[model samples]
Target: MVRWQVNLTVLWLGQFLVMGGMTMIVPFLPLYLQELGMKDPHEVATWAGLIFAGNFVTSFLFQPIWGGLADRYGRKVMLLRSGFGMAIVMTLMGFAGNAWQLLILRMVNGTISGYAPAAVALMSTNTPKEKMGFAMGTLQSGAVAGTILGPFIGGLLAEWIGYRYIFYITGILLFAASVLTLLLVKEKFNVKEASAKPKISVIQAFGQLRHVRQLPSLYGVTLLIQFAMLSTMPLMPLFVAELHGQTAGLAFFAGLVGSITGFSNMFASPILGKLSDRIGPERILGICLAGAAVLFIPQAFVHNVWQLFAARFGLGIFMGGLLPTVNALIRKYTPEGMESRSYSFNTSALSLGNMLGPVVGGAISGYFNIREIFILSTILLFINSLWVYKTLLVRKTSIEVNFEDERPR
Candidate 1:
């Protein structure tokens, strides 16, 4: 147990270092574009949307491919590949001379950035069943902490040096993280001969949908929960800009707000995971989802910058528990030999939600007001939560029977 804990901790640290380095570029990318001669706010906004969207688009598209390869080739190799690949691309991004150059690099970075998912697959494979929730939660908290710190560090670095220097620094940190992973992580590829064959196609990886009848309640709840969780993501920076402006200081403030929210999640995740273990993950998820919806609605009404900040911070507390609980619930349903494939589908679903959230939010904000975007997001989340309550929690018996039959009975 101690050895496994140590290994998991080291893996968690590696994930933290990588995430911290990678996220540093996010807060400064728009500012970097403006400096590169795209001076129009609309263009900057469009490019920013593209930059954010590009990562998810590629990451979402390629996740199952990477997951299948990891299952066959080995997760440790994939981890190394992700870390080194990202380091190389990120370093090259510092040399980008034009907006198109930077955009291209971002797209490449997105295509190759699978370190988090790799680490997730590794940790999930190694950890014992009873402690899976705790282990996954702890790992997620590390990521949340890194996400929180990245912007603060990047903002300061961008101010002191330049946005280009921020990229260089991130690249260096990522390279260092890769080195750490190579030195510490020991791979024990547990592939059975029967399962090693190419039975699962990349398309079938997304075909967890076909098994909806197998675990209808769990699947439905998970989809709704993810949708509710991601609905507010795109509106965040826009909200910050409305309260502040497009200045570097405002950008830093926006980053700070984002970081603080993520930082709060760092503390809240493990506690929520433990609570889920004691009570029930579904119940905890229901509470958190509803709380996040209620908390987020008030952001639309916040009159001042401080009020907006407070609302986001409060929202973070409820939202923090979401990812770990979702992962735990998914783990509950995953069969023993298919952990990698199950996680791939799970992450793909999350990526799908992420892809839709920003596009929808951006369109709504463009068409109406930013505040109206929040209102729309809030209403959608509320409806999603209510749907989960009706469909899943209300039909517990049917779910139990399905689970019983799916097991080797």
Candidate 2:
């Protein structure tokens, strides 16, 4: 096999393992806190939210620093740093005696976690630009597949083996992925050139991106897309209960609602990615954003669990298009030698969205109801679609045309 193809193959599995490991125990955090001796229901809820949010907060603050280091040192090194660091921290979480210890450990895990962005930077830098969309799409499918399966498997294991053991298994999975990356992923790093490049701080690096047309807007689109998609996730079970009208098999049906979207997204990502390669990521992004916005309205109106399932599945098909296309566009617009930093900033935007989405969704649900959150998400996505069209598609600069010509026919 060719080198970039080989890199993609290995890193796809690496992303799978990393994402799967990270998410496998996430759904059971409240249960785990209970096991850790948090007796009060309110206390468990508060600690669970803190433990979960801690990682993203640290990750958002630290992503740019790692991105700068990835540019100077090498993306593979950064990938290994995150994989190994997360493995160690995650294993330590298994040993925590209290909620406080788990919260701190989760924060540390976030601070060290950059595997996904590092993998993207490495793939983008190594793969042929023409195939970038496909590469990114394929990589995304791996993560989505992992996300879809992780919680289900964790739930089963929680019934059989237990929670703390799942953490150990997660650690092992991360360590194995890092070892595989170390052994199989080959990076063609230009040491002297990297050394000769002048160093810049995180703020200055972002300032550099401002000079690159459409990159900043693309980052905003990344945030908006994530925010829109995830905003409804935390409320899904309650929505399912309202639709199903009972607790019987409620968990199973709710899991189905959640996993259905990811299944469609996993299947659709590569197809849309290839389409982006042909037409242009900017166009695919706009269409998908509009489609997702439209799909959200139906979700708000769904009268049954099956209807909600169908809505989420349809929404997932469009969700598949958003981020991979955004990543492709970012690569298209960024100057060489700054790709790692650029992707890192995009990842930070993603982390911010992950943090904000659930909080805003919860607040909206509290103030009004669950259905209104979907309506609000619809509005946000609609506005985001218009923003993307005005900022990116409408301009159609000569540089984008040139980039399109470079794609495989």
Candidate 3:
């Protein structure tokens, strides 16, 4: 097997464990908050949101720094740094004495976590261009699988061993992932290539945006895609409750309803990703964008839980294509050896959208209704489709070095 094949396999497993361990906390967050001394329901709810948001805020801030370091030192180093750092932080979070300590630790976890994107960088640099889509798609499936399974497993474990032990277990899983990466992952980083270029400062990194083709709008699409996907997340359970009018199995149904998209997405991402490699990522992105836009509209009009679930599952099929294709495009356009920074910037843009999506979803749902959130996201995605057409499809990029030629035929 080629080096990239081995690397992809290791990275895939690492991403699965990291994402699974991280998201496992979501199922028990409110309960954990209560255990941390938050008594009132309102207070617990607010703190839970705050703790979740805190992680994203810091992650958004710190990703590029780690990415830049990956370019200079090695992507594998960044992977291990993120994985082990998060393990330590997560373990500490299990022992928090108060909400403040937990909040701070969550922020720390966000600040340190970058293993997924770091893995992406490593894969992007190592994989043959002809197989880039398949690698990214397969990697995306790992993350989606983790997201799909994490909460269910966590919920079961939380019941069996309690929330605090779940945190410890999560920490252990992350540590194991880091160790796997250390033992199995390989990097072909040349130190001189990074040092040969003028040392670019963080502010200078923003200036180097010119290195990417369609910089503004590519990043814009990244932000828009993430925003559209997450816009309904914060209110999903509430929407499910309203749909069924306070049913006894509301919690189970709500969780299932929310996860259906991920379920479909988990399967669809790799398939669409491989397809994108054949037809061009731009075309794949355009198709998925239009499909998602149309699918989201049905979500607003759903009269029953099953209808809503169907709409979300359909949306997931399209949603699965968006990020992997976009990243593939980003890889195609980015300057050689700067893949880490570019992916990091993309991650930061997506993370920003994540932080804002829930806020926008909350505002729209608060003012008009949960249904309106779907409507607004539909409009945004439609506009985004037009943007994708103009920026990615119509415009001819300057840096068109075909990577397939670099690969051994």
Candidate 4:
């Protein structure tokens, strides 16, 4: 097997483990809080948001710094840093005596979160650019598959084995991921380049990206997509109940609505990725954004559980391509040697969206209702489609194409 192929395999499993381990706590976060002695539903809800938001706050701050370090040293080092750091944090969360302790531990976990971005940077640079869409798409499928499975397993284990032990199991999974990445993933770092290049400051790294054509717009789309997709998450169960109207197995149906997207996304990513390689990621991104916008509207008008599920599934098919398409575009336009820094900055954008989306969604849902959140998401995605068309797809005949055009290079 080729070296890049081996790296792709390890990174796939690595992504799967890290994502799965990270999400394993999702199903029972409220239960864990109960274990920490919060009986008030309001207090538990408040603490849940706090614990989750704190991590993203630190992660958004540190991603660029880690990205710069990845470029100076190697992306593989960043992967190990993230994998081991998360393993330690996951292990420590199991021992927290209070909600504050767990929240603080989550804050600390954010400081060292780089494994997935590191893997992307390494894979983007190592794999031939010609096949980058397929590679990134395949990598995305692993993470999507993990997301689909993690919550199910977490819920089951929380019932059978308990939440604390689930933390230990998640820690073990992450540690195994670190071990796999360390043993199987090889980096072709140039000793001369490492020694010769001066250390780059985080501010300097941001400046480097600003100069790349289409990169700034692509980064903007990262935030847009994440925010649009996640905005409805906090209200999903309530929406399900609202639709099902006191039906039996409400939680089960809600869980299916929540996760159905990942299943379709996992199946669609590689296929759309190959299509992107031929038609250009910019085109695929535009089409998907428009399709997602249209699909999200039906979700707002759904009269039955099946209608909701069908909408989410169709939405997922489009969601599958948006990020992979952006990643491919980012890889194509990013200047050589700046791949890690660029991807890291993009990851930071994603973290910001993850933090902001729920807040905005919660606010909108509070002000209006759960259904309005879908309309808001639909509007955001529609605006994003227009942005893609203007920034990435329009013809530019007068000036040199530079990084703007994805025409056969």
Name the candidate that leads on lDDT: 2
What's the best-to-worst order under lDDT?
Answer: 2, 4, 3, 1
Runs in model 3 with CA error above 4 Å?
210-213, 396-409
A best-first ranking of the candidates according to their TM-score comes to 2, 4, 3, 1
Residues 300-346, candidate 1, lDDT per residue (tens digit)?
79877788778778877877777777677666666554556566666
**Candidate 4: segments with Cα more than 4 A from true spot:** 395-409
Could you say which candidate leads in TM-score? 2
Q: Write the per-residue lDDT of candidate 3 for residues 302-384, one digit (tens) a residue.
A: 88888998998998899899888878888888877778888888888988998998888787775877788788888998998
Give the total clashing residue pairs for model 1.
0
Predicted candidate 4 versus true structure: per-residue lDDT over 313-366, tens digit per residue: 999999999888888888888887888889989999999999999898888775
> Candidate 4 overall Cα lDDT vs. reference?
0.88
lDDT, residue 199, model 3: 71
Question: Per-residue lDDT for 13-107 in model 2, tens only?
Answer: 98889888888887799999999888999999999989989999999999989989998989999999999999999999899999999989999
| TM-score of every prediction relative to native | 0.84, 0.96, 0.94, 0.95
Query: How far does residue 366 in candidate 3 sit from its true spot (Å)?
Result: 2.8
Off by over 4 Å in 1: 34-44, 192-195, 212-255, 303-306, 390-409
Candidate lDDT values, in order: 0.73, 0.90, 0.87, 0.88
Clashing pairs in 2: none
In model 4, what is the error at residue 92, expressed in angstroms? 1.2
